[model samples]
Target: MKFAPSWDPTTAIAQQRRDAMLVRLRELRALEQRAVDRSAEARPVFDKRGQLLPRERVGLLLDPGEPFLPLCTLAGYQQDTREAASSIPGGGMVAGIGFVRGTRCMVVASDSGIDAGAIQPMGLEKILRLQEIALENRLPFVHLVESAGANLMRYRVEGFVQGGALFRNLARLSAAGIPVITVQHGSGTAGGAYMPGLSDIVIMVRGRSRAFLAGPPLLKAATGEVATEEELGGAEMHTAVSGLGEYLAEDDRHALGIAREVVASLGWQQERAKLESDPDKDVLLTLMPANLREPVDLREVMVRLVDGGELLEFKPAYGAATVCAQGRIAGHAVGFIGNNGPIDVAGANKATHFIQWMCQLGHAIVYLQNTTGYIVGRDSEQAGMIKHGSKMIQAVTNATVPQLTIQCGASFGAGNYGMCGRAYAPRFLFSWPSARTAVMGGEQAARTMQIVNEAALARKGQRPDPVQAKLQFDQIVEVFESQADAFHTSGLLLDDGVIDPRQTRAVLAFCLDTIAEAQTRQLRPLQFGVARM
Candidate 1:
């Protein structure tokens, strides 16, 4: 009670400071509310087809519980202007370092909220910065482009210097050893398409997206030829005809999911070995029919050979002749190739494209041989089968990735070699005991021998007996036993060995493990270049 008589001036100052802080907190809350209101106003622009914003796309691609490091957040010059500040990021692009499926990657997503996601001078700088980071860290790069090409206003403002710089950066990224993936979600026209073209893999969504060197309006005005948007640049047209994209996903979500999966498959620096449990032996025996003419589904054998729930088949409906898929055996990624016997020209083209893409992506290829030969006749020739077939062969032969050949049945003629025949130089060449490998089958062999027998009988002035011809055929079959025995090829070490059908998975797993250990010591040349779409 006696101390209350002296009041310090410092106590009064402390009370004033507390009151100031309370006032500031209230003002800050009001500011936050205003920002929320502005965002709500902008939501309709992004909701047009329910598309995600650039930031949201980045969030979806990254692994859960991981944070991203935004690259050059203030790179947009337009954002510095009052008119664009409310919509665009500092730059037209938003780039950062992020993780996908626990693997580090560099991501660059365009802001559709700003000028329809156009590329500006600052946007190009943002992309270059991210590319440089990717090169430095040896990480994969992903591009989510939904743009209207270069920003004319920015280019005019910069006096044409911006264009050269952006193209140069694109070229540099294309040459970088790290994998680059690009997805086209909206209107990717003219220069917009170039960005995705510079990437190693391009994915596009159906209906909701379009990509072209020029917009339809521009084309009609320039060439005096009118075409609809779909006719000019639909997913099907680009994927099948232009060959711009590696995959055509069903929608935006599917495209992003595929992008994540593709990146995960390619993140490793070295080939990985697969470990798989033994599949049922009887499954193989019963999978294919004994009748040579009967059509059997190739997917049955592919599913059996690869680990369950790990197969990702590419262009399933488009490529009926070849089956290309990525699968895991014991948590290791492996590429699988199987023949969809007797397919049309379209199937051949699709299969070739898949093989080429797989080789470029650097996956260990496993060939499941079961094809007669390339499609023949006038129709096939007209369809450019020769050109497409040659492309497939070149891709296979030039592939530096480890290859394993498993001949299930009917590896006849050139088709056998094309599908990892012993001549193509595979790490291991194996055959099932029942596999019939020859220039032709037994029936064809008999016909040729019968002709020879008849010619001899005619020369000797004796009637050629059907029974005698049969005896001669039997004798020839006995003599050719050395060529037919699976052990002979393995014993000579020309082929690896004859593996039991059930033991295929186990054997492959062991081989993959063995090869992976050896491959880790060497650095494979990263020579793939991004194709201009």
Candidate 2:
């Protein structure tokens, strides 16, 4: 009698429905598995430290709850069935509009899964379109590049060629004054390096990335010397020697984080208002040592000068001689450049690039002077110090943005000019009583005067008189005094007077507010287009 209950039609129907549902579920699971397998096959490369994929890196850079508007979803150009196989969304390069730190940004990430994220015709188109969008919308552009090289397969298929188009597009983006950042995640070789090189800021992940105009094989064939990828071009080599990239990140995630912070420091175009913050109380004077001979850490001063401990230092490892950063003063973004007093040619070039990039972003510039001069000797010349120094000066002089100069210590010769001296047309030039502005330091001056005194005594056929020598020395000291006093006494340098070291932050805040209030000119409108390549 109990077994008879299971014979109902309703029970039989329920069993059938369950069977059908299980079959459909199995089919969906199988489809999902196939998709995952395909995706893995496409992306063979993984982050050495985090093992994160390019898509995952993009996700990390974007703000939560914000969706991306994809670019070049249909970049593959094969008309026939077989060619369409390689045609995927994003055309091997994933590009789109996304939010980073609540600010709209145009982003392009090369997907290593597809053709090793090579530069295909379609992919180039996508990049150009994204660049256009960034310029038109006044949004910051972030590039995540990981490519083998230009795709030769596209040329075989149909209409495809490569030339100066990419460079031209980069130039346009630069001229348009949009902040462009590039991240070299993995194997940025050949033409791959150029894109990142042209960007305002280049970030590389240690071990997981390498950037060079040529790969090992090509370099070996050309130079007849075998080398490893790191030996030829790695994070340490670029950041410390070439200064091509601004920062060396521990991983892809760290690189994205750095990019986000940098963008936030630049602020948004719509806001236009300068970033402002409270002055660090009494911290500036305490940062420097009492003895002038003892070297002081410039970073300590930077930490005290900026707001929220927010200082976007550029080429930090490259130029130990000068320090450059973007910081907020009274709610306004300002570029800060100071003497590191122990940097190389690479560091100087980095400083130049940082200033140029900041000017392009429309931020005000501040120069904190304390430098000996350009690195001297044969090794420096070999490193192209003259060329790089000239470039740095060019960037400083040509910058259209407002500039402020603060002579923290000794500012000698060309170093003073590079630090935005009066000749550079700075909006305001302030100095502390401890400031020394001259063509050279006192020791160099003493030597030069001694040499002149010796020549004069030799001509007169007598040793230089001690009394006269003392007077001459006193005169030289007075000359130095006059030059040093210009920042305090002359109205040309400051409207009020020399500020105390403790008031550096407050002075900057006041200057930023004044500039923002006085600047009523509208920004020039930018035109948009695909990069020529």
Candidate 3:
């Protein structure tokens, strides 16, 4: 039987909650737009150089009108800035999944409009995340390279150490046979030169492109050598004498055109036989209750997400609180695990078995996280909650098939770890606007601390001051509550992005398709990445 919603959608309370969610979504979109606007402010400078802006270059590189799912648009949000209100997002780069010459690829463009595309600390993390995605999905990496290199004023030793991973990923991508493509639009100095050096394919724009281990100033400082910028690392010299660039263009537009042609020439389109599919009318018709605290059936969500609104539940009678099922989404088979309440010992064991079963079947796993936590207290401990929970976590960590997570609701304590939390490195993780993540609920944490403090006071033969105790409790609650907000966590790059609850199916389908494509595609691995002679 198809699951049905239990709550009335037309109620005023539901509408108000949805409105609040929409408001938060709008704020997210506005911040994303602000990054674009901040980058656009450099258009005049770009125009003077006869160069297209970063977004414009990305637009030209991507196929016209095909969906582009921008990743980490708020990566550096409120990070590397003094105040949240004045913070610029996008991490000095625009990166996403988009079609290039009809082939889906990971695209990254340096937002040189801001700070000459200097690498912010979070920006480094953002690129590392993108590289990880491209590698995991076996997607071609297309980078529009331009930067002033690292900002010396903001340099940190840790950041310097972390920067090595960026180049290492480039080498890894090439070694894995996933193509590494670079478009050298401007400066790439010092260690940055490795970008083009490590790529399988390099396209450079004449006069503008620069890639050298040391610029004139550094060279002069080290060896007292005098040389012009052109003599050091100009595109003309690299393409002619150094043989570092295979394709050279006159301008930004011409360079992008070459890059597109190169991608189209890869013959990367290998289509999988289409399976008969169910329409999404049922999914669209269902609306999740706006009040996040209210209990709702996990089945209601499963029916809306799976193909034909059907699911074959696995071990339903046992560990009823932990729902496990097999379902198809967009014609691809997948296993889903969702929570209805705190996981008991039985629930943990049930989930562990289900995870291994799915891996054996070679189906990807989708985790719908909505658990308060694993069951706590004396009875649960004796029943082996710790060991059972550990088994589930172990199963999740070693599952051969891809795993994806959606923070649909409360993700607290070790429950998050068992459900493939961000720390466990799910292939992709997204959060709903209503989702909240923390070690425990704010009230519970406050109460726990109060109990501890009161006991300590009693040992000292002192009675707690009622007013002061209340104030302390309030402060603790505020700390946890503010940090647990989905928006706040999202701003901190805790998930891929905060998405509308209604768009969960679409997002899942897109991610599944990406993984399927990678599995089927053939690659040519090499002992080493391509190198400039």
Candidate 4:
């Protein structure tokens, strides 16, 4: 049956919710800009040194007019400082996927304006995630290097140990045939030297580029030697004697131009044209209710997303709550699994079967999450909820095709794991402004804890004070409610991003196209990464 729209966007409630969502989006955009502005604040210093800012370099490197999707813009928000007001986002780096000479690539630039681009713990994690994405998608990796390396004063032993994975991934990317290009615009010292050392290609700025295992002071301390910065590891020396850098440029802009030329020369081209839906055909389709509490018919959403608004429902009646269907999004065959409610034994079984069948068909799966959790009750326990839910999770974990997720509503308890949450590492995960994620609803969590507290008091033969009990319950609710807000969790790097609900189809289409392109591209893998010598 063709789905019809019942949503009334003109309603007062709808307008109010939209206003709230817009506020959140504005806040998000403002936080993102904080990093840019913070970096841009060093504009004068950069001007004095005759160099472009990090953002400027990124803009110059990317093809004009093409979309640049910034990633992890809030990775270290409220993490680097004690006070939330003072903490800056982006972890001292700017990263995104954008077109470099018409070839989509992952671009990372050091926000040296902030603390000399010292690598924060979250910044390291963000880089690793970017490398993973580039490797997975067979996209070229372009890193604009300039860092003072890890901040020694604030460093931890665990972070130091985990830092090895960063260089290891560089090797892996090269071995997988994906290019690792480095533009050494400023500094690369100590452990940071490996950045340019492992790259498939390195572009170094003549006077400013620096890549040395030990600077003058460290060298003097370790070995009674005297050497100038230029003699030690300057771009001129590296490009001439050490053979570390491949391309030599006069300045940052020149280096960026060379990087663009390098990408243009790669002969990389999209394997197929994007499949865009006809606007005229899709005009009649409407969005589902923005109020997450309202009962959302998954069909209503699917119609707006799929091409021609057609879907092939699977086991529609058996596991009615778990909706599994086959549809095409922007011409790519996709399997979609969405929940109408908690997963029961029947729902788990139905979803597992659907997942396996989709894998067999070589179709990518998109999870539309909206669930409380597996149904919990005496009858559900007897019906083997745990064992059946495990099956569904197993299928999600080991699925052969790419998995993408969008948190449409409540994503609580084991429901998140089963729905390919961030922990599960979906290729991409996005959330709507109305989405809420937690172990359970605030009220339910508070009540469960209240019961537990009461039981403990009974064991001690002490009656609970009414006022104290209410206070504890309210506290639990506040904690859960605050963390579960989409904006708060997004600041913590919980999802790729929080997106506007109206743009869901466009975002999904972009992601699907990225995956499809990766499917058709070929790489030339080597036993080891390209060697500097």
TM-score of each: 0.45, 0.44, 0.94, 0.94
Instruction: Rate residue 428 of model 1 by lDDT.
Output: 62
Flag regions of model 2 displaced more than 4 Å: 1-38, 42-49, 77-87, 153-163, 269-533
Q: Mind giving the per-residue lDDT tens digits that candidate 1 earns over 367-451?
A: 8877776777898889887787776777678776778888766677667666778778776667755454666655556677888
What is the number of residue pairs that collide in model 4? 0
TM-score of 3: 0.94
Query: Of the candidates numbered 1 and 2, which has the greater TM-score value?
Result: 1
**Which window of ten consecutive residues has the lowest lDDT sum in model 2?**
1-10
Error of 2 at 523 (Å): 5.7
RMSD of 1: 30.0
Whole-model Cα lDDT of every candidate shown, in order: 0.64, 0.65, 0.86, 0.85
What is the clash count for each candidate, in the order shown? 2, 18, 0, 0
Give every collision pair in model 4. none
Residue 229 in candidate 1 has what lDDT? 87
lDDT of 3 by residue, 51-116 (tens): 999999999999996767788777877666647678888789999988898898999999999999
Ranking by lDDT: 3, 4, 2, 1
Q: How far off is residue 89 in model 3, in Å?
A: 2.0
TM-score of 1: 0.45
Weakest ten-residue segment in model 1 by summed lDDT:
1-10
Model 4, residue 282: displacement in angstroms? 13
